[model samples]
Target: MWISRLSRFLDSVKQTLFILGTGLVIFLALRNSIVWHMQEFWGASGDFWQRRWEELYLLFNQDDFLLSVFGTYIFTTAVFWLCNLFFILLDLTGKPEFLLKYKIQADKNTPLRPADFMKAAKVALYNQTVVGLPMSVMIFCVMKWRGCSCSPADMPTFPWSVVEVTIFTLVEEIGFYYTHRMFHHPRIYRFIHKKHHEWTAPIGLVAIYAHPVEHALSNLLPVALGPILLGSHLATAWMFWALALFSTTVAHCGYHLPLLPSPEAHDYHHLKFNQNFGVLGVLDRLHGTDAQFRASLAYQRHFLLMSSMPVTQQVPEPPKKKSVSE
Candidate 1:
């Protein structure tokens, strides 16, 4: 029995890894292809930045800009990973039973209609375009105001220090954590966040997908907060933006593999509507919100099993549709 169970566990691991690896490859291919075309189009522009190996090395040697960029990268990535780590642990180990209990039912009989897919796509595009462009511009303006040079060659020179990055990381974390939770509050959620929740089981495309107001509020806070609190340079800010987008996409992809947390961690919250609230950790544990989440999962599994029984034992279907003329 133990051997059989071990074999099943290994098979599950393999399947999960396969899904995650494929998703990542697809994401990278799409992202890089778009980035390449964008570069080709804008490369000649004086304001556009081209990422090249030589230039990257040169930029690193420039103490001030390099220090700032590296600091921001470490800070943001650390906070993002740490938060995901905490939640994954909670979901996977702290409550392994939660996984089996709260499995989301795939409504096979009522497959996701075309309309649902379109709505999700539309919301995703609208949210990204409306919020991303304006926020990018605002961040650019702020960087200019702060006298931070954007050009790779013109970057400032400063000593590399862990202390600086640590401080910046804390500021960004606090800003993101509070802003994220605030949007989920009932009052704000109705107006700003409800649209994103339309896809309870998100599939990566809907990662940044949100209502315009919510999108603006969510994206702008980190951009604005970094400059005001940490006085980060433009390069650092841009890196932060890229990392944030990548991480958000991963969180919504609904697959887990080595080196990353499971989408189950975040997807479960959306499925049940209340729990795992923190972007950086399991805040639900401290606040007792996870209780309902546990119960909801159990409720979902019971219904799912009942719904999956043979058609003979299932409820009768509605009468067949009559002809339009009839």
Candidate 2:
């Protein structure tokens, strides 16, 4: 018991470090570029700088923020959206029957009908383009104002760049866990988070299928938090967004692929409704929510058995044969 508790504690600590590390990388990356401009225009040192505030306000107003917001969000979202859509289609097509083993809720997944797939795809994509896009724009605006770069030159190259992206990803996941939990509040869930839940058996693109407010707050905000806090490079932030989007997409893909974060965790969240709220399940475990979630899963198994729904239950192994001598 103590060993398990310690493991969870370490995971939380590692995640905290990732957040701080990401912020540090951003601050360092932006210091010469964005921050330098900030200091120069605002005056590095001045009388409690009330004038600097006025100057900064004018700079904010004059800069082409709308272009920055829309352009960055659209481009980054498109790149990963395509990547996600590709994998989703791959899973649906299942060129090799062996790949089916990766499916999570295997029995519950109805035979893929062209009409049904299209309908689900349509709704998911619609939500992303409409609701998700605006949220991304807003999040980009916040990160830009706070000092994250929009210039490619600002990004550190190659292996080193991975560090920045890696840390920010961890930070984003942690931020998402808490923000998502709040979205499930009784008052908020029906009005906002419920839209995403409409598809109990979610598809890849459902990652972004959500109410506008929920997308902005629960989805984009957590993602945006890392770059804003870190003051990350444009490329670093871009890569982070790409990876985070892919992760969410796969988590909704309804697959239980080995050596990958499968859909099981979030699938349970969607189906069961009240448990497994965290992206990585670290926060859920630390908070003891995972125990409740596991219990619910057990209940589901029991219910399926009691209802004699063999089709929905996993196939049991055949009884062992005994030797005649025994």
The prediction achieving the highest TM-score against the true structure is: 2
Go through the candidates in order and give each one's C-alpha lDDT.
0.52, 0.65
**Where is model 1 poorest over a 10-residue stretch in terms of lDDT?**
299-308
Identify the runs in model 1 with alpha carbons over 4 angstroms from their true place.
Answer: 1-115, 154-169, 282-326
Worst 10 residues of 2 by lDDT: 302-311
Clashes of 1: 4
Return the TM-score for each candidate structure.
0.52, 0.67
lDDT of 2 by residue, 67-121 (tens): 3565455666686568576555655676466556555566644345566567666
Clashing pairs in 2: 23-230, 26-231, 102-256
Task: Provide the global lDDT of candidate 2 against the true structure.
Answer: 0.65
* Cand. 2 TM to true fold: 0.67
Tell me how far the alpha carbon of residue 199 in candidate 2 is from the true structure, in angstroms, after superposition.
Answer: 2.5
Candidate achieving the largest lDDT: 2
Residue-level lDDT tens digits of model 1 in 1-326 = 77755665565456445533564566568986865764565545424343442365465674443434453444443454454453344333434433322223333212335565566557655654555555555655566567765456643232222233334444555565566678888887888778778777665556657777766666556545655455555555555555565667666654443344434446766776666554433234334445565455332322222232322234233479999999
Query: How far off is model 1, as Cα RMSD?
Result: 15.9
On a 0 to 100 scale, what is the lDDT of residue 316 in model 2?
Answer: 41
Residue 325 accuracy (lDDT) in model 1: 100
